[model samples]
Target: MITKSIKGIGKAVGVMLLIIFGVQHVEAQQFFSYSQYMNNLTPLNSAYSLIDKNGTLNALLRKQWTGIEGSPSTFIFNGNLPIESINGAAGLIVMNDQFAVEHLTEINGFFAKGIQLGNNQFLGVSLNAGIRRYVANYSSLDAVDPQFRNDVRENKPNIGFGILYYSDHYYVGVSLPELSIRDLGNASTQRADFFRNHFNFAGAYLFGKEGDDVRAKPAVLATYTKGVPFIADMSTTLYFKSILGIGVNYRTNNEMSGIISISSDIIKLGYSYQFGTSATNLGGRLSNATHEVTLSYRFGQNTMSRSIL
Candidate 1:
Protein backbone atom coordinates (compact mmCIF):
# COMPACT_ATOMS: atom_id res chain seq x y z
CA MET A 1 0.00 0.00 0.00
CA ILE A 2 2.85 2.40 0.73
CA THR A 3 4.37 1.73 -2.69
CA LYS A 4 0.99 2.30 -4.32
CA SER A 5 0.64 5.61 -2.53
CA ILE A 6 4.11 6.64 -3.66
CA LYS A 7 3.29 5.73 -7.24
CA GLY A 8 0.14 7.81 -7.06
CA ILE A 9 2.11 10.77 -5.81
CA GLY A 10 4.66 10.46 -8.61
CA LYS A 11 1.91 10.33 -11.22
CA ALA A 12 0.28 13.43 -9.75
CA VAL A 13 3.56 15.29 -9.94
CA GLY A 14 4.21 14.08 -13.45
CA VAL A 15 1.01 15.69 -14.69
CA MET A 16 2.52 19.15 -14.27
CA LEU A 17 6.26 18.37 -14.17
CA LEU A 18 6.76 19.54 -17.80
CA ILE A 19 10.48 18.96 -17.30
CA ILE A 20 12.21 15.67 -16.58
CA PHE A 21 13.38 14.02 -13.38
CA GLY A 22 15.93 11.30 -12.94
CA VAL A 23 16.08 8.34 -10.66
CA GLN A 24 19.35 6.41 -10.36
CA HIS A 25 19.09 4.75 -13.76
CA VAL A 26 16.05 6.19 -15.53
CA GLU A 27 16.68 9.09 -17.91
CA ALA A 28 13.60 11.27 -18.20
CA GLN A 29 13.79 14.72 -19.78
CA GLN A 30 10.91 16.70 -21.19
CA PHE A 31 10.09 20.32 -22.02
CA PHE A 32 8.86 22.95 -19.61
CA SER A 33 5.25 24.14 -19.66
CA TYR A 34 4.50 27.78 -18.82
CA SER A 35 1.08 29.27 -18.29
CA GLN A 36 2.08 32.36 -20.23
CA TYR A 37 3.32 30.54 -23.32
CA MET A 38 1.17 32.80 -25.47
CA ASN A 39 3.44 35.71 -24.66
CA ASN A 40 6.92 34.24 -25.25
CA LEU A 41 6.90 31.26 -27.57
CA THR A 42 10.53 31.43 -28.56
CA PRO A 43 11.28 28.57 -26.19
CA LEU A 44 8.82 26.37 -27.99
CA ASN A 45 9.23 27.51 -31.57
CA SER A 46 12.15 29.56 -32.87
CA ALA A 47 9.96 30.87 -35.66
CA TYR A 48 7.85 32.75 -33.14
CA SER A 49 10.52 35.47 -33.24
CA LEU A 50 9.27 36.51 -36.65
CA ILE A 51 5.95 37.59 -35.22
CA ASP A 52 7.43 40.66 -33.58
CA LYS A 53 8.82 43.33 -35.84
CA ASN A 54 10.62 45.03 -32.97
CA GLY A 55 13.56 44.00 -30.83
CA THR A 56 12.33 42.36 -27.66
CA LEU A 57 13.82 40.86 -24.53
CA ASN A 58 11.82 38.69 -22.16
CA ALA A 59 12.59 37.11 -18.79
CA LEU A 60 10.37 34.55 -17.09
CA LEU A 61 10.36 32.58 -13.84
CA ARG A 62 8.20 29.63 -12.80
CA LYS A 63 8.02 28.29 -9.25
CA GLN A 64 6.03 25.16 -8.53
CA TRP A 65 5.07 23.78 -5.13
CA THR A 66 6.06 26.94 -3.38
CA GLY A 67 7.56 26.56 0.08
CA ILE A 68 8.83 23.10 -0.70
CA GLU A 69 12.58 22.68 -0.67
CA GLY A 70 14.14 21.79 -4.01
CA SER A 71 10.79 21.82 -5.73
CA PRO A 72 10.59 22.35 -9.49
CA SER A 73 11.60 25.77 -10.79
CA THR A 74 12.48 27.24 -14.18
CA PHE A 75 14.03 30.43 -15.56
CA ILE A 76 14.30 31.64 -19.14
CA PHE A 77 15.94 34.64 -20.82
CA ASN A 78 15.16 35.32 -24.49
CA GLY A 79 16.14 38.07 -26.93
CA ASN A 80 15.12 38.66 -30.53
CA LEU A 81 16.31 41.08 -33.24
CA PRO A 82 14.07 41.47 -36.26
CA ILE A 83 15.74 41.98 -39.66
CA GLU A 84 13.29 43.47 -42.11
CA SER A 85 15.90 43.46 -44.84
CA ILE A 86 15.70 39.69 -45.23
CA ASN A 87 12.31 39.25 -43.57
CA GLY A 88 14.03 37.25 -40.84
CA ALA A 89 14.90 37.34 -37.15
CA ALA A 90 17.84 36.25 -35.03
CA GLY A 91 17.70 35.52 -31.32
CA LEU A 92 19.24 33.88 -28.31
CA ILE A 93 17.38 31.64 -25.84
CA VAL A 94 18.61 30.30 -22.54
CA MET A 95 16.68 28.12 -20.10
CA ASN A 96 17.35 26.49 -16.76
CA ASP A 97 15.14 23.89 -15.08
CA GLN A 98 15.71 22.38 -11.67
CA PHE A 99 13.83 19.91 -9.53
CA ALA A 100 14.90 18.05 -6.46
CA VAL A 101 18.61 17.27 -6.78
CA GLU A 102 18.59 17.41 -10.58
CA HIS A 103 19.45 20.37 -12.79
CA LEU A 104 19.30 20.92 -16.58
CA THR A 105 20.53 23.99 -18.41
CA GLU A 106 20.48 24.69 -22.14
CA ILE A 107 21.73 27.65 -24.16
CA ASN A 108 20.73 28.10 -27.80
CA GLY A 109 20.96 30.56 -30.71
CA PHE A 110 18.47 30.59 -33.57
CA PHE A 111 17.87 32.18 -36.97
CA ALA A 112 14.49 32.41 -38.66
CA LYS A 113 13.41 33.76 -42.04
CA GLY A 114 10.06 34.24 -43.67
CA ILE A 115 8.54 34.74 -47.12
CA GLN A 116 5.27 36.13 -48.38
CA LEU A 117 3.15 33.32 -49.78
CA GLY A 118 0.12 35.39 -50.71
CA ASN A 119 -1.23 38.90 -50.42
CA ASN A 120 -1.27 38.68 -46.60
CA GLN A 121 -0.15 35.18 -45.78
CA PHE A 122 3.43 34.45 -44.82
CA LEU A 123 5.46 31.35 -43.97
CA GLY A 124 8.54 31.18 -41.78
CA VAL A 125 11.17 28.64 -40.79
CA SER A 126 13.77 28.55 -38.03
CA LEU A 127 16.79 26.54 -36.92
CA ASN A 128 18.43 26.45 -33.49
CA ALA A 129 21.69 25.03 -32.17
CA GLY A 130 22.67 24.68 -28.55
CA ILE A 131 24.23 22.58 -25.81
CA ARG A 132 22.44 20.88 -22.89
CA ARG A 133 23.97 19.90 -19.58
CA TYR A 134 22.26 17.61 -17.06
CA VAL A 135 23.40 16.93 -13.53
CA ALA A 136 21.93 14.69 -10.86
CA ASN A 137 23.40 14.70 -7.37
CA TYR A 138 21.81 11.50 -6.13
CA SER A 139 24.23 11.18 -3.23
CA SER A 140 22.59 14.22 -1.70
CA LEU A 141 19.38 12.29 -1.26
CA ASP A 142 20.85 9.24 0.50
CA ALA A 143 24.60 8.96 0.57
CA VAL A 144 24.66 5.70 2.54
CA ASP A 145 22.41 3.89 0.10
CA PRO A 146 24.27 2.16 -2.73
CA GLN A 147 21.60 3.22 -5.22
CA PHE A 148 22.23 6.86 -4.43
CA ARG A 149 25.99 6.74 -3.86
CA ASN A 150 26.98 7.76 -7.37
CA ASP A 151 25.98 10.92 -9.24
CA VAL A 152 24.97 11.25 -12.88
CA ARG A 153 26.12 14.00 -15.21
CA GLU A 154 25.87 14.28 -18.98
CA ASN A 155 26.30 16.90 -21.67
CA LYS A 156 24.76 16.74 -25.11
CA PRO A 157 24.41 18.93 -28.16
CA ASN A 158 20.89 20.06 -29.06
CA ILE A 159 19.24 21.00 -32.35
CA GLY A 160 15.73 22.19 -33.12
CA PHE A 161 13.59 23.57 -35.95
CA GLY A 162 10.20 25.19 -36.45
CA ILE A 163 7.87 26.16 -39.28
CA LEU A 164 5.07 28.71 -39.08
CA TYR A 165 2.29 30.00 -41.32
CA TYR A 166 0.75 33.17 -40.10
CA SER A 167 -1.12 36.36 -40.90
CA ASP A 168 -2.42 39.29 -38.86
CA HIS A 169 -5.24 37.59 -36.96
CA TYR A 170 -4.25 33.93 -36.74
CA TYR A 171 -1.39 31.49 -37.08
CA VAL A 172 -0.48 27.82 -36.94
CA GLY A 173 2.83 26.02 -36.70
CA VAL A 174 4.68 22.86 -35.71
CA SER A 175 8.13 22.43 -34.25
CA LEU A 176 10.65 19.91 -32.94
CA PRO A 177 12.50 21.86 -30.29
CA GLU A 178 14.63 19.12 -28.69
CA LEU A 179 16.16 16.54 -30.99
CA SER A 180 18.82 14.48 -29.31
CA ILE A 181 21.38 12.95 -31.63
CA ARG A 182 22.84 10.42 -29.20
CA ASP A 183 22.12 8.75 -25.89
CA LEU A 184 23.50 10.05 -22.61
CA GLY A 185 25.31 8.36 -19.72
CA ASN A 186 24.93 4.63 -19.08
CA ALA A 187 21.35 4.62 -20.26
CA SER A 188 20.95 2.72 -23.51
CA THR A 189 19.30 4.16 -26.60
CA GLN A 190 15.85 2.89 -25.57
CA ARG A 191 16.08 4.18 -22.00
CA ALA A 192 17.37 7.51 -23.26
CA ASP A 193 14.47 7.92 -25.65
CA PHE A 194 12.64 9.79 -22.97
CA PHE A 195 15.05 12.71 -23.24
CA ARG A 196 14.95 13.52 -26.91
CA ASN A 197 12.64 14.43 -29.79
CA HIS A 198 9.75 16.43 -28.40
CA PHE A 199 7.28 17.79 -30.92
CA ASN A 200 5.03 20.81 -30.34
CA PHE A 201 1.96 21.68 -32.38
CA ALA A 202 0.35 25.03 -31.74
CA GLY A 203 -2.15 27.47 -33.24
CA ALA A 204 -4.14 30.52 -32.24
CA TYR A 205 -6.90 32.81 -33.53
CA LEU A 206 -7.77 36.39 -32.65
CA PHE A 207 -11.30 37.70 -32.34
CA GLY A 208 -12.38 41.34 -32.77
CA LYS A 209 -11.71 44.05 -35.30
CA GLU A 210 -8.64 46.23 -35.58
CA GLY A 211 -8.47 49.25 -33.26
CA ASP A 212 -11.10 47.63 -31.07
CA ASP A 213 -10.95 48.53 -27.41
CA VAL A 214 -11.42 44.90 -26.41
CA ARG A 215 -10.33 41.75 -28.17
CA ALA A 216 -10.18 38.05 -27.47
CA LYS A 217 -7.77 35.31 -28.53
CA PRO A 218 -7.88 31.55 -28.13
CA ALA A 219 -4.85 29.30 -28.42
CA VAL A 220 -4.11 25.59 -28.48
CA LEU A 221 -0.78 23.86 -27.90
CA ALA A 222 -0.12 20.14 -27.98
CA THR A 223 3.08 18.30 -27.21
CA TYR A 224 4.15 14.71 -27.86
CA THR A 225 7.21 12.95 -26.53
CA LYS A 226 8.16 9.33 -26.31
CA GLY A 227 6.76 7.29 -23.38
CA VAL A 228 4.10 9.86 -22.50
CA PRO A 229 0.60 10.56 -23.61
CA PHE A 230 -0.11 13.55 -25.80
CA ILE A 231 -0.22 16.69 -23.66
CA ALA A 232 -2.36 19.63 -24.66
CA ASP A 233 -3.06 23.13 -23.37
CA MET A 234 -6.16 25.12 -24.26
CA SER A 235 -6.38 28.79 -23.43
CA THR A 236 -8.39 31.92 -24.20
CA THR A 237 -7.30 35.43 -23.30
CA LEU A 238 -9.07 38.77 -23.30
CA TYR A 239 -7.01 41.84 -24.08
CA PHE A 240 -8.06 45.32 -23.02
CA LYS A 241 -6.69 47.86 -25.48
CA SER A 242 -3.31 46.07 -25.45
CA ILE A 243 -2.77 47.19 -21.86
CA LEU A 244 -4.24 44.43 -19.73
CA GLY A 245 -4.70 40.69 -20.29
CA ILE A 246 -6.68 38.03 -18.47
CA GLY A 247 -6.80 34.40 -19.43
CA VAL A 248 -7.10 30.79 -18.28
CA ASN A 249 -5.45 27.54 -19.37
CA TYR A 250 -6.58 23.94 -19.02
CA ARG A 251 -4.24 21.04 -19.57
CA THR A 252 -5.21 17.54 -20.58
CA ASN A 253 -3.96 16.31 -17.23
CA ASN A 254 -6.80 18.20 -15.55
CA GLU A 255 -4.51 20.96 -14.33
CA MET A 256 -5.91 24.48 -14.61
CA SER A 257 -4.44 27.97 -14.43
CA GLY A 258 -5.44 31.62 -14.30
CA ILE A 259 -3.30 34.34 -15.89
CA ILE A 260 -3.27 38.14 -15.78
CA SER A 261 -0.99 40.80 -17.18
CA ILE A 262 -0.51 44.58 -17.49
CA SER A 263 1.59 46.14 -20.19
CA SER A 264 2.64 49.34 -21.89
CA ASP A 265 4.33 50.07 -25.21
CA ILE A 266 7.79 49.39 -23.75
CA ILE A 267 7.29 47.04 -20.79
CA LYS A 268 4.96 44.26 -19.68
CA LEU A 269 4.34 42.20 -16.56
CA GLY A 270 2.41 38.92 -16.35
CA TYR A 271 1.47 36.28 -13.78
CA SER A 272 -0.14 32.84 -13.69
CA TYR A 273 -1.33 30.43 -11.00
CA GLN A 274 -1.94 26.71 -11.54
CA PHE A 275 -3.86 24.10 -9.56
CA GLY A 276 -5.20 20.58 -9.97
CA THR A 277 -8.66 19.13 -9.83
CA SER A 278 -10.08 17.24 -6.85
CA ALA A 279 -9.46 13.98 -8.65
CA THR A 280 -5.72 14.52 -8.41
CA ASN A 281 -5.62 16.08 -4.96
CA LEU A 282 -2.78 15.21 -2.58
CA GLY A 283 -4.78 15.42 0.67
CA GLY A 284 -2.63 18.37 1.81
CA ARG A 285 0.63 16.43 1.75
CA LEU A 286 2.13 18.97 -0.69
CA SER A 287 1.21 22.38 -2.04
CA ASN A 288 -1.06 22.00 -5.02
CA ALA A 289 -0.55 25.50 -6.33
CA THR A 290 2.11 26.82 -8.78
CA HIS A 291 3.05 30.41 -9.49
CA GLU A 292 4.73 31.90 -12.57
CA VAL A 293 5.82 35.45 -13.34
CA THR A 294 7.15 37.11 -16.48
CA LEU A 295 8.61 40.52 -17.39
CA SER A 296 9.24 41.68 -20.96
CA TYR A 297 10.74 44.72 -22.69
CA ARG A 298 10.15 45.73 -26.29
CA PHE A 299 11.97 48.34 -28.35
CA GLY A 300 12.61 49.33 -31.98
CA GLN A 301 9.87 50.61 -34.26
CA ASN A 302 6.48 49.01 -33.62
CA THR A 303 4.98 47.50 -36.70
CA MET A 304 1.80 46.35 -34.96
CA SER A 305 2.42 47.00 -31.27
CA ARG A 306 2.48 43.38 -30.05
CA SER A 307 1.58 40.02 -31.44
CA ILE A 308 -1.93 38.84 -30.60
CA LEU A 309 -0.60 35.30 -30.10
Candidate 2:
Protein backbone atom coordinates (compact mmCIF):
# COMPACT_ATOMS: atom_id res chain seq x y z
CA MET A 1 0.00 0.00 0.00
CA ILE A 2 2.90 2.40 0.73
CA THR A 3 4.47 1.78 -2.69
CA LYS A 4 1.14 2.30 -4.44
CA SER A 5 0.56 5.56 -2.64
CA ILE A 6 4.04 6.81 -3.61
CA LYS A 7 3.45 5.99 -7.27
CA GLY A 8 0.10 7.78 -7.22
CA ILE A 9 1.67 10.90 -5.78
CA GLY A 10 4.44 10.86 -8.37
CA LYS A 11 1.90 10.63 -11.19
CA ALA A 12 -0.06 13.59 -9.79
CA VAL A 13 3.09 15.65 -9.57
CA GLY A 14 4.06 14.85 -13.14
CA VAL A 15 0.63 15.90 -14.41
CA MET A 16 0.82 19.20 -12.56
CA LEU A 17 4.25 19.96 -13.93
CA LEU A 18 3.12 19.25 -17.46
CA ILE A 19 0.09 21.49 -17.04
CA ILE A 20 2.11 24.42 -15.76
CA PHE A 21 4.79 24.03 -18.41
CA GLY A 22 2.24 23.89 -21.19
CA VAL A 23 0.43 27.00 -20.02
CA GLN A 24 3.61 29.00 -19.49
CA HIS A 25 4.96 28.02 -22.87
CA VAL A 26 1.95 29.57 -24.49
CA GLU A 27 2.41 32.79 -22.56
CA ALA A 28 6.19 33.07 -22.68
CA GLN A 29 7.39 36.52 -23.71
CA GLN A 30 9.18 36.39 -27.03
CA PHE A 31 9.75 39.33 -29.31
CA PHE A 32 6.80 39.85 -31.65
CA SER A 33 6.56 40.85 -35.37
CA TYR A 34 8.96 40.54 -38.33
CA SER A 35 9.33 44.14 -39.53
CA GLN A 36 11.35 45.03 -36.46
CA TYR A 37 14.15 45.29 -39.02
CA MET A 38 12.44 48.32 -40.49
CA ASN A 39 14.04 50.72 -38.02
CA ASN A 40 13.24 48.94 -34.72
CA LEU A 41 10.21 51.20 -34.26
CA THR A 42 8.19 48.95 -31.96
CA PRO A 43 7.84 51.49 -29.13
CA LEU A 44 10.29 49.48 -27.02
CA ASN A 45 12.74 52.28 -27.79
CA SER A 46 11.95 55.98 -28.14
CA ALA A 47 14.81 56.81 -30.50
CA TYR A 48 13.18 55.19 -33.53
CA SER A 49 10.25 57.53 -33.24
CA LEU A 50 12.14 60.25 -35.09
CA ILE A 51 14.02 58.26 -37.72
CA ASP A 52 11.70 58.83 -40.61
CA LYS A 53 12.25 61.65 -43.11
CA ASN A 54 8.54 62.23 -43.67
CA GLY A 55 5.47 61.64 -41.54
CA THR A 56 4.93 57.86 -41.41
CA LEU A 57 2.00 55.80 -40.22
CA ASN A 58 2.44 52.03 -40.09
CA ALA A 59 0.52 48.99 -38.88
CA LEU A 60 1.76 45.43 -38.43
CA LEU A 61 -0.23 42.25 -37.75
CA ARG A 62 1.41 38.94 -36.98
CA LYS A 63 0.01 35.41 -36.60
CA GLN A 64 2.50 32.97 -35.13
CA TRP A 65 2.25 29.15 -35.12
CA THR A 66 -0.81 29.07 -37.32
CA GLY A 67 -2.48 25.75 -36.50
CA ILE A 68 -1.22 25.26 -32.97
CA GLU A 69 -3.73 25.63 -30.17
CA GLY A 70 -3.41 28.93 -28.31
CA SER A 71 -0.71 30.25 -30.59
CA PRO A 72 0.61 33.80 -30.19
CA SER A 73 -0.64 36.79 -32.13
CA THR A 74 0.35 40.44 -32.10
CA PHE A 75 -0.74 43.76 -33.57
CA ILE A 76 1.06 47.08 -33.63
CA PHE A 77 0.12 50.60 -34.74
CA ASN A 78 2.61 53.45 -34.75
CA GLY A 79 2.97 56.96 -36.21
CA ASN A 80 5.76 59.51 -36.27
CA LEU A 81 6.06 63.10 -37.41
CA PRO A 82 9.04 65.41 -37.32
CA ILE A 83 8.65 68.97 -36.08
CA GLU A 84 11.02 71.12 -38.09
CA SER A 85 10.27 74.23 -36.04
CA ILE A 86 11.33 72.53 -32.82
CA ASN A 87 14.14 70.46 -34.38
CA GLY A 88 12.57 67.30 -32.95
CA ALA A 89 9.70 64.85 -33.39
CA ALA A 90 6.85 63.33 -31.39
CA GLY A 91 5.18 59.99 -31.94
CA LEU A 92 2.74 57.41 -30.58
CA ILE A 93 2.78 53.61 -30.51
CA VAL A 94 0.32 50.97 -29.39
CA MET A 95 0.60 47.19 -29.34
CA ASN A 96 -1.37 44.14 -28.22
CA ASP A 97 -0.03 40.62 -27.78
CA GLN A 98 -2.05 37.52 -26.99
CA PHE A 99 -0.99 33.96 -26.18
CA ALA A 100 -3.45 31.35 -24.99
CA VAL A 101 -5.42 32.99 -22.14
CA GLU A 102 -2.83 35.67 -21.42
CA HIS A 103 -2.74 39.13 -22.97
CA LEU A 104 -0.67 42.31 -22.77
CA THR A 105 -1.42 45.79 -24.05
CA GLU A 106 0.99 48.70 -24.28
CA ILE A 107 0.79 52.38 -25.19
CA ASN A 108 3.64 54.84 -25.42
CA GLY A 109 4.71 58.31 -26.54
CA PHE A 110 8.11 59.32 -27.88
CA PHE A 111 10.16 62.51 -28.43
CA ALA A 112 13.42 63.02 -30.29
CA LYS A 113 15.95 65.71 -31.21
CA GLY A 114 18.14 65.65 -34.28
CA ILE A 115 21.73 66.90 -34.57
CA GLN A 116 23.20 67.65 -37.98
CA LEU A 117 26.39 65.72 -38.79
CA GLY A 118 27.15 67.33 -42.18
CA ASN A 119 27.64 65.19 -45.34
CA ASN A 120 23.84 64.69 -45.38
CA GLN A 121 24.00 62.58 -42.20
CA PHE A 122 22.33 63.43 -38.89
CA LEU A 123 22.50 62.07 -35.34
CA GLY A 124 19.48 61.75 -33.06
CA VAL A 125 18.56 61.19 -29.43
CA SER A 126 15.15 60.12 -28.26
CA LEU A 127 13.11 59.54 -25.08
CA ASN A 128 10.05 57.42 -24.48
CA ALA A 129 7.38 56.92 -21.78
CA GLY A 130 4.91 54.05 -21.77
CA ILE A 131 2.33 52.08 -19.85
CA ARG A 132 1.48 48.38 -20.05
CA ARG A 133 -1.21 46.11 -18.64
CA TYR A 134 -1.08 42.35 -18.20
CA VAL A 135 -4.13 40.13 -17.88
CA ALA A 136 -4.54 36.40 -17.26
CA ASN A 137 -7.53 34.07 -17.21
CA TYR A 138 -7.57 31.66 -14.26
CA SER A 139 -10.99 30.28 -15.11
CA SER A 140 -9.62 28.47 -18.11
CA LEU A 141 -7.21 26.49 -15.94
CA ASP A 142 -9.81 25.46 -13.36
CA ALA A 143 -11.65 23.47 -16.02
CA VAL A 144 -8.52 21.44 -16.78
CA ASP A 145 -7.52 20.59 -13.21
CA PRO A 146 -9.37 20.51 -9.92
CA GLN A 147 -6.22 21.71 -8.13
CA PHE A 148 -6.73 25.08 -9.79
CA ARG A 149 -10.04 25.58 -7.98
CA ASN A 150 -8.68 28.39 -5.86
CA ASP A 151 -7.00 30.28 -8.73
CA VAL A 152 -8.01 33.90 -9.12
CA ARG A 153 -7.73 36.24 -12.10
CA GLU A 154 -5.15 38.99 -11.84
CA ASN A 155 -4.06 42.21 -13.59
CA LYS A 156 -0.93 44.27 -13.20
CA PRO A 157 0.43 47.62 -14.38
CA ASN A 158 3.92 48.22 -15.79
CA ILE A 159 6.01 51.25 -16.81
CA GLY A 160 9.27 51.58 -18.69
CA PHE A 161 11.75 53.88 -20.51
CA GLY A 162 14.50 53.72 -23.20
CA ILE A 163 17.13 55.75 -25.11
CA LEU A 164 18.48 55.47 -28.67
CA TYR A 165 21.16 57.01 -30.90
CA TYR A 166 21.02 56.88 -34.67
CA SER A 167 22.25 58.19 -38.00
CA ASP A 168 20.70 58.00 -41.44
CA HIS A 169 22.06 54.49 -42.05
CA TYR A 170 22.42 52.86 -38.61
CA TYR A 171 20.99 52.85 -35.08
CA VAL A 172 21.69 51.34 -31.64
CA GLY A 173 19.29 51.46 -28.75
CA VAL A 174 18.50 49.97 -25.30
CA SER A 175 15.25 49.99 -23.41
CA LEU A 176 13.62 48.55 -20.31
CA PRO A 177 9.95 48.34 -21.07
CA GLU A 178 8.98 47.10 -17.59
CA LEU A 179 11.32 48.89 -15.25
CA SER A 180 8.92 49.51 -12.36
CA ILE A 181 8.19 46.89 -9.69
CA ARG A 182 4.82 46.02 -8.25
CA ASP A 183 3.50 43.55 -5.69
CA LEU A 184 2.15 40.21 -6.85
CA GLY A 185 -0.13 39.88 -3.87
CA ASN A 186 0.49 38.37 -0.42
CA ALA A 187 2.22 35.01 -0.24
CA SER A 188 4.05 34.07 2.97
CA THR A 189 4.28 37.72 4.06
CA GLN A 190 6.31 38.72 1.00
CA ARG A 191 5.32 39.67 -2.55
CA ALA A 192 6.83 37.91 -5.55
CA ASP A 193 7.57 40.01 -8.65
CA PHE A 194 9.61 40.19 -11.82
CA PHE A 195 10.68 43.14 -14.01
CA ARG A 196 11.45 43.04 -17.73
CA ASN A 197 14.56 44.62 -19.22
CA HIS A 198 15.13 44.63 -22.98
CA PHE A 199 18.28 45.61 -24.85
CA ASN A 200 18.38 46.14 -28.62
CA PHE A 201 20.88 46.98 -31.39
CA ALA A 202 20.09 47.44 -35.06
CA GLY A 203 21.72 48.70 -38.26
CA ALA A 204 21.17 48.89 -42.02
CA TYR A 205 23.39 49.48 -45.05
CA LEU A 206 22.34 50.80 -48.44
CA PHE A 207 24.33 49.64 -51.45
CA GLY A 208 24.27 49.21 -55.22
CA LYS A 209 24.33 52.90 -56.18
CA GLU A 210 22.03 55.66 -54.96
CA GLY A 211 20.87 56.58 -58.49
CA ASP A 212 20.42 53.06 -59.78
CA ASP A 213 16.97 51.80 -60.63
CA VAL A 214 17.63 48.73 -58.48
CA ARG A 215 19.46 48.60 -55.17
CA ALA A 216 20.33 46.12 -52.44
CA LYS A 217 19.75 47.00 -48.79
CA PRO A 218 20.97 44.79 -45.99
CA ALA A 219 19.92 45.02 -42.35
CA VAL A 220 20.48 43.33 -38.99
CA LEU A 221 18.73 43.42 -35.62
CA ALA A 222 19.80 41.94 -32.27
CA THR A 223 17.99 41.83 -28.94
CA TYR A 224 18.53 40.49 -25.40
CA THR A 225 16.47 40.37 -22.24
CA LYS A 226 17.06 39.56 -18.59
CA GLY A 227 15.81 35.96 -18.75
CA VAL A 228 16.34 35.16 -22.43
CA PRO A 229 19.41 34.67 -24.53
CA PHE A 230 20.42 36.90 -27.43
CA ILE A 231 18.43 36.73 -30.68
CA ALA A 232 19.55 38.09 -34.05
CA ASP A 233 17.97 38.62 -37.46
CA MET A 234 19.89 39.26 -40.68
CA SER A 235 18.25 40.15 -43.96
CA THR A 236 18.96 41.59 -47.40
CA THR A 237 16.40 43.09 -49.72
CA LEU A 238 16.54 43.99 -53.41
CA TYR A 239 14.64 47.09 -54.32
CA PHE A 240 13.34 47.15 -57.90
CA LYS A 241 12.80 50.49 -59.61
CA SER A 242 12.35 52.09 -56.17
CA ILE A 243 8.83 50.70 -55.92
CA LEU A 244 8.99 46.96 -55.10
CA GLY A 245 11.21 44.91 -52.81
CA ILE A 246 11.99 41.24 -52.09
CA GLY A 247 14.14 39.87 -49.33
CA VAL A 248 15.13 36.85 -47.23
CA ASN A 249 15.87 36.70 -43.50
CA TYR A 250 17.49 34.23 -41.09
CA ARG A 251 16.54 34.52 -37.42
CA THR A 252 18.76 32.81 -34.85
CA ASN A 253 16.99 29.75 -33.39
CA ASN A 254 13.75 30.71 -35.03
CA GLU A 255 12.97 30.51 -38.76
CA MET A 256 14.02 31.41 -42.30
CA SER A 257 11.77 34.05 -43.78
CA GLY A 258 10.87 35.49 -47.19
CA ILE A 259 9.53 39.01 -47.51
CA ILE A 260 8.04 41.27 -50.16
CA SER A 261 7.06 44.92 -50.25
CA ILE A 262 5.14 47.01 -52.78
CA SER A 263 4.98 50.75 -52.59
CA SER A 264 3.14 53.47 -54.45
CA ASP A 265 3.54 57.22 -54.21
CA ILE A 266 1.68 57.35 -50.90
CA ILE A 267 1.05 53.83 -49.55
CA LYS A 268 3.13 50.71 -49.00
CA LEU A 269 2.23 47.09 -48.38
CA GLY A 270 4.55 44.41 -46.94
CA TYR A 271 4.33 40.71 -46.13
CA SER A 272 6.60 38.02 -44.71
CA TYR A 273 6.53 34.22 -44.25
CA GLN A 274 8.62 32.27 -41.75
CA PHE A 275 9.45 28.60 -42.36
CA GLY A 276 9.97 26.46 -39.29
CA THR A 277 13.43 25.00 -38.77
CA SER A 278 14.39 21.49 -37.67
CA ALA A 279 14.25 22.55 -34.04
CA THR A 280 10.48 22.70 -34.31
CA ASN A 281 10.26 19.07 -35.47
CA LEU A 282 12.01 17.80 -32.36
CA GLY A 283 8.69 17.80 -30.55
CA GLY A 284 7.27 15.20 -32.98
CA ARG A 285 4.57 17.66 -33.92
CA LEU A 286 4.58 19.85 -36.98
CA SER A 287 4.64 23.45 -35.79
CA ASN A 288 2.74 26.15 -37.57
CA ALA A 289 4.95 28.85 -39.08
CA THR A 290 4.55 32.61 -38.70
CA HIS A 291 2.86 35.06 -41.08
CA GLU A 292 3.07 38.85 -40.93
CA VAL A 293 1.80 41.82 -42.91
CA THR A 294 2.31 45.55 -42.71
CA LEU A 295 0.77 48.68 -44.24
CA SER A 296 2.28 52.13 -44.22
CA TYR A 297 1.30 55.59 -45.45
CA ARG A 298 3.52 58.63 -45.87
CA PHE A 299 1.88 62.01 -45.70
CA GLY A 300 3.12 65.44 -46.83
CA GLN A 301 6.07 66.03 -49.20
CA ASN A 302 6.40 63.20 -51.67
CA THR A 303 9.77 61.72 -52.50
CA MET A 304 9.43 62.72 -56.15
CA SER A 305 8.67 66.32 -55.23
CA ARG A 306 11.67 66.49 -52.92
CA SER A 307 13.96 65.22 -55.67
CA ILE A 308 12.59 67.69 -58.19
CA LEU A 309 12.86 70.61 -55.80
Work out the TM-score per prediction. 0.87, 0.78
Query: By TM-score, how accurate is candidate 2?
Result: 0.78
Output the number of the lDDT-best candidate: 1
The superposed Cα distance between candidate 1 and the true structure at residue 232, in angstroms, equals: 0.5
lDDT of 1 by residue, 1-309 (tens): 677656545544553242332231122214677888887788999898998899999999998777755677899999999999999999999999877767788899999999999987899999999998877776665555586677877888999999999898888999998888876764333235436688999899889976689999999889888766677889999999878899999877667889999988788899999876544333123576689999999999884476666
- What's the distance in Å from true for residue 285, model 1? 5.7
Residue runs of model 2 more than 4 Å from their true location after superposition: 1-29, 33-36, 39-42, 143-146, 149-167, 172-178, 181-195, 281-284, 302-309
**For residue 96, what is the lDDT in candidate 2?**
86
Name the lDDT of candidate 1: 0.79
- lDDT of each residue in 136-198, candidate 2, tens digit only: 553354444455434333445555555555554455566655555555542212111223455
Query: What TM-score does prediction 1 earn?
Result: 0.87
lDDT of 2: 0.62
